[model samples]
Every structure is written in structure tokens, then in C-alpha cells.
Target: AAGTLIVGGGQAGFQVAASLREAGYADPVVLIGDEPGLPYQRPPLSKAYLAGKTDAEGLNLRPASYLAEHRIAHRPGTRAARIDRDARRLILADGESLPYDHLVLATGARNRDLPVPGADLAGVRQLRGLADADRLREAIGAAERVVVVGAGFIGLEFAAVAAAHGLAVTVIEAAARPMARAVSAETGAFFRAAHEGWGVRFAFSAGVTAIEGTDGRATGVRLAEGDVLPADLILVGIGVVPNAELAAEAGLAVADGVRVDAFLATEDPAISALGDCARFPSAFATGLGRDDTVRIESVQNAIDQGRCLAARLAGRPAPYGAVPWFWSDQGRHKLQIAGLAGPDDASVLRGSGDAFSVFRFRGGILRAVESVNRAADHMVARRLLAAGTPLTPEQAADPGLDLKALAT
Candidate 1:
């Protein structure tokens, strides 16, 4: 009997499987992955991998021997079609059914496609999986000019890589600023300047109306302003839609993602969700007495949720209380964020020179921290937030009181 069945073979699924083994859960564990390779890190795809600093082998999370030695059954290139809740079985594409005592839906997400006239052109691409990255790397190496369709994290990241390689890169964003939804305007401006310093061009408030191509090969992108920008390659880094279709089809409630409680358990107690696909309550905030849905798409979130879920599944039922953190490597600067900040939150700048930290405040209460090229600050923020330490804006503004010192 399949003791536990994981429906995604990315970070979360692999992490939970490992955590279960570490916690002394000997029941059979099976990981099902739609992707055709060993689980790997997605963050490097936009940075190290794109820049040729790392290869596929370097990005793997686990080796084949490790999985085998752990007695974990890994099913690669196998898709879980549906979940039969009544029978406690998972339907596979190959007409096979696997019985599970506990189920984890870590289906992750897929890139949102560019809906335009020439979106189907040969050169148009989206980077969500390994296959997408492989195609992007090959296209970038051969292209003279590339048009990026978005100013989000993925778009800017790919732009940085392209610019570092001395390729002519144009980034088009419908929004006014970069990472407008995720970071403060100050941080966005800082990143914009950093990318600009690397010779990346931006077209803010511009939308791609169509992708112009010839003979099914992309040649240019038409903007909303009736302007056509010529390009040999087009990379669409718009955003990603959660792969919650499976859960929805299985009659599980899916809002932005598979909705889970504070314990990371779905409405069905036997089923749990994590990673980019699970919309669980913010444990850090909720434990501090704030109730809100906090679905995050970061490596840190994936790992923490996976570990927490595993601990609970192993009969230890610990409330999922993890501070959300994220990082992005753009050019020489590393943008790190600790905690979740809302759009209306006020931002205060701390530190100076090339390294700085932006403290986000909501009603005089420290909500989050965004640091660029300041690893120490990011670490401190994580610790303080996880420890439920109170931080005021006045304290954050004081340069003498470093984040690390305050945390101590």
C-alpha cells in the first residue's frame, strides 16, 4: 500500500518525503512528478543557469542514489490525473491507481501565457520549467535582440542575464514600476537603476498588443501604443497561474490556490497542500493574532511548508508557524525580503551606500523588511520575525542599531 503519495516532485514534495524519513516515519512514500528529470531548484534557472554559471547537474535537489538509499519511490514523467477522495486513490495518466493514506498536492504552477496575435510564434517562450529554461538558453545564445514581456521578477531576472551577456534587451511592463506588487517603490527604483546600469532598457506602462513574426518565427513585438519593437527572440515572464485544476476537479476548494487552514490541512483532513500551490493562513501573522490568507511563491515558503506538513503528518501536529522569506539575484545585488508587506505599507530606508534595507511599516508596526545586497539584515529580519520580536520604524531608522544588534 502507498502510505503517502505526493503529487508534485519539486522542492516541497522532495522536502516532505525527506522530512518524513528524518522524523522516523517508515511508511511507504511515493513522489509523483510530471517533469521528466530529477527534482531541481527553479531559482537558478533565471540566474546561474541562464548565465552559464551552473548546469542542470548542479541544480538537482537530490541524486538518484540518495532517493534509492532512502527507500523513497520517485515516479518521474508521471502525471496524477485525479484524486478519488472516497476511495483514497490517485488516478494516473497511465490508467493506474495508487492507494494513499495521506495525500499531498504540491502541483506547483505553470507560467501564464501571453495572449496576443503572434503569441504562437516560434521564438516566444515562457520560463517556468526546465524545458522552458533549456529552450530560452538556446534561443538567447542565437538571438541578437530579445524582447521581454513583463517587469516582474522573472522578466527582470532574465533581462539582467541577457544584459550581462551584452545582448540588447528591452523589457516591457504594463505596470509603472518593477515588482510593484511585491516590493516598495524605493526598492523597485533601486533595482531599475541597477538593471539600467547593466544596459537593460525598459518600457514601463507598455503592453504587448501582438508579437510580429514572419514565417512562424518571431521578429518583433507590437506595443499598446502602436509602436513595434524589433526583436529576434521574445521571452514572456508575465506571471504564473497556480496548477490548482487538479484540486478543483477533485472537489477541493481552490481560491487563488488550494485553500488550507493554519495547520496546512485542507477541508479534507487526509489531504494537505504546500509550496506554490497552497494558500495557507499566515502562521507568523496569525500566531501574532492576525488572520489572513498568505500564499507565497518562494523557495523558503516551499521548504518550510513541506517540513511543517511532514512533521504534522508524522503525528506531531505542530501549528505551521514559519516566517516567509524570499530572495532574487539580479546583477551584483541580491534582493532579500523577510515577512510580507502590503501595498499601502510605509517604507523606511535604513543603511546607506551600495547596501541598504527597506523596512515596511503598517500603522507604525513593522510588517516586513526588504534588503538589497545586505545579507546580514535579511538574516536578522528572518530571525526577529520568526521570534515574534517587535520592531518600530524609529528603531529601524536608527543606523547605529543594526538589525542584527536589535535581534540580539
Candidate 2:
């Protein structure tokens, strides 16, 4: 008998299963994953994994012995076909069903498809899961020139890795700046320069029209502006679409993702959602004058949400109010951001030189801090934001005042 049924074996699902055992709610926690391997972290897929600095063994979040020792049933290469909400059971792909007292949906998200004319070419790839990363890694090594569509974090990160390996890398983006949706323009410009300094070319404000291929192999990418960029390999990194079809089919309220309450519970009390697949009421303001739904795609968000949902299932219901944080690794720059800043916010620079911090202010209140190659400042920003301590722009800009001390 399965005590808890977790759908999707990514980071969020694995964390919840581990947390349930840690919280002493052990009966039989079973994790069903569609992928054919152990649960692994996705962040390293674009960075160290592609750089060959770490192998598959290093990517596993937990060893097989740990799961076995905890008596957690790990089911890989298994897909959850559907959910019978009334019966509280999950129908598997192999014509089997598992009943659960509590269910956790960590279905995560999949890479959005590039609907261009030549998207189906053999050399075109999208990096999202572990398998995708493995294929891209192989392609990157054999290809001389790589054209990346969309200048988001994943695209830029992969470009940096390819450029570091002396491969000709060109990043095409529809927007004027990279990561315009997530970071401030200052931070975006900083990364653009950093990647450019490392020999990565940028095609800003360029939209890809199609991927030109010969004999089923991608030859180059055709832009909307009628320019053909020659490439032996192409990677699509537009964004990701949440895997919320399961929740929607089960009649749960679905907007951008599986809709959840403050406690990470869906409309159905017995079911919960977390990680990228979940869009819950955010604790931070989205500049829309009210709390809106947010679907964060970061390791920190997944881990924190997993822990919070597990605590709720353990009968210690707590509102998920974690300070949203994110990080991106491009070349030698370790860009870290604490708190979410809106487009209307004002940015202030604190330090000068290779290492500096950018403080985001909205209506005289400190909203976020973006640190570049400054680990210490990033740590302090996380602590200060978590404590809800107020820091004005003047105080934050003071060069002599230590951020860690002020945060305390």
C-alpha cells in the first residue's frame, strides 16, 4: 500500500518524499518519474555538466543507498497517466493504479517548443531535463558553430560554456537585453558584457524565423529579418511551459500553472502542488497592486516549496512565504539576486570594480539586491530580506557599512 504518492521524480518530488520520512510520516512514500534515471538537479545541467566538470554520478541529488535505507520506493521510467481525484488514486502508464492518502504533484515543466519551420531538424535541441542536456553536450563538442535561440539564462549559460570551449557561439534574442524579464537592465548589461568578453556573440532583437536544414541535419537558423546565421548545431531556450495538464484534467483550478493556496494546497484538500508546476499566491508583490500567482523556476524555490509542502502534509501547516531568490552562472560571473524586483523599480549601484552590488528600490523601500561575483553580499542580502529588515538606498549604498552586520 502506498502511503504517499508523488508524481514526477524531479527535485521537488524527491525532496518531498525525503522530507516526509524525515518528519516521521513514514508509511510508504513512492515516487513515480517519467524519466529513466534517478532524480537529479537541473541547475548544473547547463553549467558544470556541459563543461564536463561533473558527470552523471555527481548530478544525483541522493545516492540509491539513501533511498533504499529510508525504504522509499523509487519508480523511474514510469509515467502518471491521469489522476482520479474522487478516488484519490493515480493511474500509471502500465495500466496500474496506486491509491494515496496524500498526493504531491511535482510534475515540473517542459521546454517550450520552437514553432519555426525547420524546428524538427535533427541538430535542433532543447535543454530542459537530464537527457536533453546529455544530448546537447554531445552535439556541442562535435559542432564547430552553435546558434542558441533565446538569450534567457539557460541559453546564455550554454553559450558561455560553448564559447569557453572555443566553439563559435551566437545567441539570438527577441528582446533588446538578455534576461530582461527576470533581472534589472543593469544586471542584464553586466552579463551581456561578461559573456561578450568571453567571445560569445549576441544578436539582440533578432527573432528566428526557421531552422534551415539539409538532409534532416540543421545547417543554420533563418532570422525573421531575413538573415541566415550559419550553424552546425542549434539550441532552443525560449522558456518552459508548466506541466499543469494533470491538475487541469482533474478539475483543479488552473491558471498559468496548478493553482494553489498559501499553504501550497490545491482546491482539493488531499492534493498539493509545488515547484515549477505550481502557481501559488506570492508573498512578494508583483507590482500589480495585489498578490498574484508566481511560478518560480529555480533550485531554491523548488527546495523551499518542497519542504513547506511536506511540513503541511505532516500536519504542521505553514504558509509558504519564502523570500524568492535566484542565481545564474555565466563565464566567471556568479550573478545572485535576493528578492524579486519589478520593472518600475529604481536601481542603485553600491560598489565599483569587478565585484559590485545593485540595490533595487521601489517607492523608497528596498525590494531586491543583485550581486555580481560577490558571494558575501548575496548572502547578506538573503539574510536581510528574510528578516524583513528595512534598508534605505542611502544606507545600502554606504561603502563602509558592512551588509552582514547591518542585516543582523
Candidate 3:
């Protein structure tokens, strides 16, 4: 009999399989992935892997032997054509069917493609999967100048790597500041200043009209005003879109992603969704007077949600509730965020300069914390948020008190 079937062999899918075995669920667990390889971590693709600091073996969450030893059957480079909910089977692209008792959709996401003239040029690259990263690493080696479209985390990380290599890096952002969607204005300004100090150029409030090229190879980027920024390479890092088409075709609820409840379960009992593809009402948000749901895209969320789902399937039923956190490494700076912070959340500054934290408050209650080069503050903030500990803006802004001590 089938035990558990997980679609999409990314971090979430791998974690779910691993967690199931750890929880003593001894049934057939089949992980089907469209990618060709053992499940690997995607985080390093734009950073360490791109920078040549780490190799492909290091990006792997588990070695191939571990998967085989654990009896977690993984179908690498195999795509799931559709979900047969009524028959409780997953239809493969090759016309094979795999029956399952429980299904976990960790379809994840794909990088948003740039729609403009000459976007399909030879040197125009996007960093998403291992293949993309591999191509980009090779491209960067011969590139004299790099132009990045978008100022999001991925864009900045790639820009940092390029800038460090002494390449002329120019980042174009349609928004007023970097990371406008994720961080507050204060935090955005701080990062902008930091990136500028690193010899990276920024063109904020600028829209890309087209990509200029010769012989079908990217050579430069053309702005909305008809001015072209010369470049030998172009990396588009403009966020991502959930791979929710399969779920939607199967008639599952889908908005920005597959909509699930607090338990990460869909309306149908047999199927569930996790990671970047699942949009669920957050307990953390609700506690802070936010009635809506949020779809988080991060390694931490995927791992935590996978473990939560695994436990429930192992006959230890519990609602999925965990404080969300994320981190980004841009050059020497490590920016970490604990809990979810909305755009309109009131932000209070704690500390100053290179090492600092931004306490985000919603309705006078601390909702999230964004820290730059402050690992201790990030850890403490996570604990406090997880335990529902009260922390006022006044207390957070004061440098005299110890944030970590209060967490305990």
C-alpha cells in the first residue's frame, strides 16, 4: 500500500519525506521531482554556489545514499502530469500512475520572467534552479559588466557577488528603494547606503524599456527614457510566482498560491500544500490583528511546514503554527528577519549604523523584527515572538535594555 506521495522535490518535499521517516511512519514514501538530481537546497544557487565558495555536493540537503538508505523513493527528472484525486493517484508525464494514501504539494515557485524586447538574448540569464546557477557562474566569469533588473533579495545577492568580483554592477529598481515589498523604508535606506558604499550603482524609480543586444546576445539594458546602460551580462531577479497551476487544474483552491487552512490542509482531506506554493492563514498574523492569510517563500518556512505536516501524518495531529523567519546574505552583511512584517507595519529603530534591528509593530504589539548583522537580536526576537512575549516599541528602541535577556 502507498504511504505518502510528495510532489516537487525541493527543500519542502525532501524535508517532508525525511521527517516522515524520523517520525517512524513506515510506509512507502515516493518523492517525484521534475529536476534531474537528488533533492538540493536552492539558497546557495545565487550566493555561495555562484561565488564558487561552495560546490554542488555542498548544496545538497542529503546525499543520494541517504535517500536510498532511508527507502525514500525519489523519481528525479520525472514530472507529475496531473492529480487523480478520485482515484488517489498521481499521473506521471510518461503515462505511469503512482497511488498514494496522502499527498503533499510542495510545487514551490519559479522566477518571474522579464517581458521586454531582447529579453531572450544569449547573455540574459535568470538564477532559479541549478542549471540557471551553473550557466550564470560561467557567464559571470567572462563578463566585464553586469546589469541586474530588480532590487529584491535575489537581485541584491547576485549584485553583491558580481560587485565583489570587480565587475561594474548596476541594479535597476522600479520601486523607490530596495526591498520595498519586504522591509521598511528605514531598513531599505540602510541597505541602499550599504550597497552604494560597495561600489554598486542603483537606478531607483527606473523602468526597463528593453534589452539591447547584437547577434542575439545581450549587450545592454535600455531604460524607459530611451537611455541604454551597457552590460555584457544581465540577470533578472524580479521575485517569483507560485507553481500552482497543477493544483488549480485539479480544482483545489488557489489565490496567490494554493489556499490552505491553519493546518496547511486543503478542502480535500487527502491532499495538503506547503512552502512557497501554499497560502494559509497565519496564526502569527491573526495574533497581531491581521485577519488575512500570507504565502511565505523561504527555506525556514518550507522546512518547518514540512515537519509539521509529517508529524500530523504520523498520527501525531497538531495544527501547524510556527514563527516565520528569513535570512539573506549580501556580501559581508547578513540580514535576518523574524516573524512576518507587512508594508504598513510601524517600524521602530533599535541600535544604529552597521549593527541594528528594526522592530515592527502592528497595533502597538510587536509583530516582527528585521536585523542587520545582528544574529543575537534575531535569535532573541524569534523566541520572544514564538512565545507571544510582550515587547513595547519603547523597550525595543531603548539601547540600555538587553533584548536577549528579556527573551529568556
| lDDT tens per residue, model 1, 247-347 | 89989999989999988899998899999999887744532334578678999989988899988988898878788899998988899999988766889
Clashes of each: 0, 0, 0
Identify the runs in model 2 with alpha carbons over 4 angstroms from their true place. 286-291
TM-scores, in order shown?
0.97, 0.97, 0.97
Q: Flag regions of model 3 displaced more than 4 Å.
A: 286-291
- lDDT against the true structure, per candidate, is 0.89, 0.89, 0.91
Question: For residue 72, what is the lDDT in candidate 3?
Answer: 97
Query: Residues 1-408, candidate 3, lDDT per residue (tens digit)?
Result: 788999999999999999999999999999999999989999899889999999998988999899998999999999999999999999999999999999999999998889898999998889889999999898888999999999999999999999988899999999999998888898899888888888899999999999999999989999998899999999999989999988898999999899898788999899999999999888667543345788899999999999999999899878888999999999889999999887889999987889989999988999889999999989999999999999998888787988778889
Candidate 2 has its poorest 10 consecutive residues by lDDT at: 283-292
Question: Any runs in candidate 1 off by more than 4 Å, and if so which?
Answer: 283-291
lDDT of model number 3 = 0.91
What is candidate 2's lDDT per residue for 26-126, written digit by digit as tens?
A: 67899999998889999999999989899998999999999999878999999998899889899998989999988899999999999889899899999
